[model samples]
Target: MNRKELEQRLRQELALPYYNAKIAERDYSESEFQEMKAQLQADIEQYARDYVNESNANG
Candidate 1:
């Protein structure tokens, strides 16, 4: 998804109500979720780079 779609989906997911209190529950607001979405996207990019580097190095 693009940046706008990610931001929109994050807001929609945050609006969902929680049915149970679990320790693994995320307690972030809409803004925080947006930030997390960006961070995760960045992480995926970094992971791909790392994988490519490792593969090239091994080859």
Candidate 2:
């Protein structure tokens, strides 16, 4: 997915109000942004694995 879509998913998964703001107003530091990106990537990978596992189990 694109950056915006990823951010939206991350926001939902994180359930944090800080992520609900507009990108420009978020004003996160470089390190913080990197950390969030890493977390998002990890979460996405985990979700993919879960989906595959669930599908296999159901199939």
Candidate 3:
């Protein structure tokens, strides 16, 4: 997927609850959030690099 699509999918995935909540809302922990952020950042950078390389080769 493209960068925008990838990011949008990630956002949707984050909204999904991984655990059940009896009285409180379910959400990601600090480590989980950080891991997700790191993955997103890496994917974004890879996408940008790929795009640039493809454009250069096409030209």
All models: lDDT?
A: 0.57, 0.65, 0.57
Q: Mind giving the per-residue lDDT tens digits that candidate 3 earns over 1-59?
A: 43444344456655533322222334545565567557766876899999999999999
Tens digits of per-residue lDDT, candidate 2, 1-59, equal 44565466567656644564345534455566668767766876899999999999999
Q: On a 0 to 100 scale, what is the lDDT of residue 51 in model 2?
A: 100
Pairs that collide, model 2: none
**What would the TM-scores of all predictions be?**
0.53, 0.57, 0.57
Candidate 3 segments whose C-alpha is farther than 4 A from its true place:
1-25
Off by over 4 Å in 1: 1-27
Candidate 1, residue 25: Cα displacement in angstroms equals: 2.4
lDDT of 1 at 16: 27
lDDT of 1: 0.57
